[model samples]
Target: MTETLQSLALSIIELATFIFVFIFLAAIVWLIWAYISDIRQKKQAIRRNFPVIGRFRYFFEHLGEFFRQYFFAMDREELPFNRADRSWVYRSAKNVDNTVAFGSTRNISAAGEILFLNCPFPTLEADAVPPSAITFGEGQARQPYTTSSFFNISGMSYGAISKPAVQALSQGAAKAGIWMNTGEGGLSPFHLEGGADIVFQIGTAKYGVRDDQGQLSESRLRSVAAHEAVKMFEIKLSQGAKPGKGGILPAAKVTQEIADIRGIPVGHASISPNGHPEIKSVDDLLNMVHRVREITGKPTGFKFVLGAYGFLETMLKSIHERGLEFAPDFITIDSADGGTGAAPQSLIDYVGLPIKESLPLVVDKLIEYGLRDRIKVICSGKLITPASVAWALCTGADAIVSARGFMFSLGCIQALQCNKNTCPTGITTHDPDLQNGLDPTNKAERVAQYAQKMVHEVGVIAHSCGVREPRELRRYHAHIVGDNSFSTSLELLFPTRSVKPEYDKRK
Candidate 1:
């Protein structure tokens, strides 16, 4: 009888707890509805008179954005921007659902148009032939590097991006046959994973393998070049996102592991000098390039954001005066619109020339010097779609490098928390808790898959343009929108067929 009474008492207590929980949940739902209704009804009135609350409107508006982005929205239903593009990255990376639906969400009559390859009758399969590797320079100094499929991961430093993210990118690049660039953060073991081919970037800082005085160390550079996977070396003069201003990796994001990899003190932020102290003029830069090339015996290139008021023209003149038969193996032109890990709001919003405008200028300048064939041009900045890449190739760029698009592939929700080290998908975060969720092995395969799909799709586009390969795409292959009608972008930029530089030495 006593045992039965105790059991009864326990059941009663459990029932009361359940009732309380239900009531609490219902109250929360009602309160949320009431608040939303109240705000909607009084928003105009509050805006007119309540000065303090009006100021808070922006905060509330931004807060609503957060809720809509992470919680309230569905995977297939984000407005103005949806998850379809990112979903394609994830699907391609996993080698799943590589199919095209009947209709596009895009409006055909929109002002800004997206072009597609209308494969006349039948669709083409992925190309079987391997991309030919380009050999830069002549004789013993020559080095060969192959162009993998359409996709290649752009430079993001070990310090700027987490170790696991680096490891995953490295492993993925190896698996995909694409190359990876070591963005000015210096070399770390994470870059070695899966034995991916690497392009070691020497930035303004010259952080890794520096001399005692923190200058570019020839011996150290040679040692790095000797590594089998380090196929190329690039001199970074400036990046697209924030030209002139150097790269910065914040101290708060720098974990102990990052500190050791970059060889910096744990508490201080890693600051790159605005320009290379050793290289001041064009001649100095060329000489530095010669030394690096002579020491490494590998393909040497330079990356920059172009803003020289005839500085390129001057540089071309200097090359001729010096009797330098060859120029850089390749040149990466980053447009002003490119994304960065973090940057000043002013710089991000209003600095540098957009790629659409800058690409034609740089290409024309190089051609004017009669150096177009000798030097390859790689374009970066805002290449998000098949149409964009197609347009870039059509504009005289040898290749295109994508950054944010790949991050989307890694499932970045664009939480905009990359600088804070709180990226949701583990692509940019340093926190152990968040990173543990990103499985390198799985994510690496996804990277490979996405690369292959992008390449395949690009190949299809190439075929429709009546071109056998991507390299054949030229300015005339595409058209652009004008105020009145549609005309080729090339025609608009080059009014005449013989658009030579005003001061072409060849003339």
Candidate 2:
């Protein structure tokens, strides 16, 4: 027995030694190959100079973004959205208690900080009323749209986000009684599945409503308008993220379904024209609007990011010359800092006006031109939080829309992989394995909760300001922090311009 045991132990030891030797040889072979490859590579200077050792730099650099988000960054320090803002959205979506234990981490005295003026005698709960319903294209379109939802889900194309993400947003928007914009990708069946009011966007590409030659097809326009849920049509002159550019869907994301819906070829990168080819001048724009409204019998509007002020004045003047009936039902002003699936870094960072400067400018211009009552102003660009929504109402926006805000409700971690096909949370990716992480039914509930809570919190702000409802909020109800760390009334900074008496008389 002793002799047999010794022989077995020796055999086991020999097996272990052989395995280790094989692994060591394999490691050496891999290292030698990698070293040779790195030395020969001309694309990366660090790899060429340092060989295998420099490869770690790229790996470490990729890891740094994750490390900074989880550890090094402060609650209020992150860009696009800070940890505090994301945390609030998460809690709100989860329908959990979102109250902070101690003081706020926000820099209250920072320039551009918004401060609401609380009334000594705030509006009592007994006196507070729900937001009044605002109707679009009243007495004009055969089927006008009227909704009281103050905060709504903005345009996020089906192709830009995953199938489940669109499903969840549509379901949630229905439950929350808010409208969903079917972005520029066009209307898919998922958009209709939830029974929510839909706003079909007409991109420069013309997408779902385009003919075989990529021109606007009247038959397709009639078909889309035929859907009862499609409440309005928005002509996307330009999105905020790429003001002078167009929508870009990578070939990898352009699956058959998305391609069919967008009227583009499968597995091809879908890039829209920079601007509407047919609609060149302001007159052409109004003509297009009239054409769409006549065909669809729905509220028709155009969305654009503000840059040159002269065109706006020309557009408004032309509206007067033509008729109020020729004017757009709404004007959607997109902010410079808006989010998108893909855009050039230069356009995203430096091209257009941020919401802070642009919203008030557009609102005041509308009032000055006596079109404030005629044209409903819907502003979008990072107005995710309740305070920001309230500020927009005060600044004269009839409604506020958010895209990334809803994405957070759908469990986006801001991995910044939107342009890529590897979104970790499955909100922006088309990968079936990644998309499995998102259950449309479950995430839909979270979406509803986020929208409901946002509207509730904005109401809280409105009540605190002694207003009966959100729309009652005026510019004087809020203050903006100045460079001196002192605050000035928003009403003073952007003084309310009087409507021209001639146009006011027409109203």
Error of 1 at 10 (Å): 4.3
Q: Which one is best on lDDT?
A: 2
Minimal lDDT window, size 10, model 1: 122-131
**What lDDT tens digits, residue by residue, belong to model 2 across residues 72-160?**
99999987899999999999999999898779899999999999999999999999999999999997788999999989999999989
Root-mean-square deviation of Cα positions for candidate 1 versus the true structure, in angstroms: 5.8
User: In lDDT terms, how accurate is model 2?
Assistant: 0.94
Candidate 1: segments with Cα more than 4 A from true spot: 1-62, 67-84, 98-102, 108-132, 138-142, 146-150, 485-492, 495-507
Clashes of each: 1, 0
Best by TM-score: 2
Pairs of colliding residues, candidate 2: none
TM-score of 1: 0.83
All candidates: TM-score: 0.83, 0.96
Residues 1-507, candidate 1, lDDT per residue (tens digit)?
Answer: 999999999999999999999999998897666556556665576644553455477788768867987778775467423566666666777778767788766544444454443445433445334443555554325575655444577889887777677878888889888888899988788898679888899988786768767788888887788788888888998887678888888887777776666556786888888899988888788787777877888877788887764788788777667755436778888888786488777877788888887788878777777667567788888775667788887777777887777776666676777777778777787778998888888778777777777777676677776666666666666666555445434545553234356435456
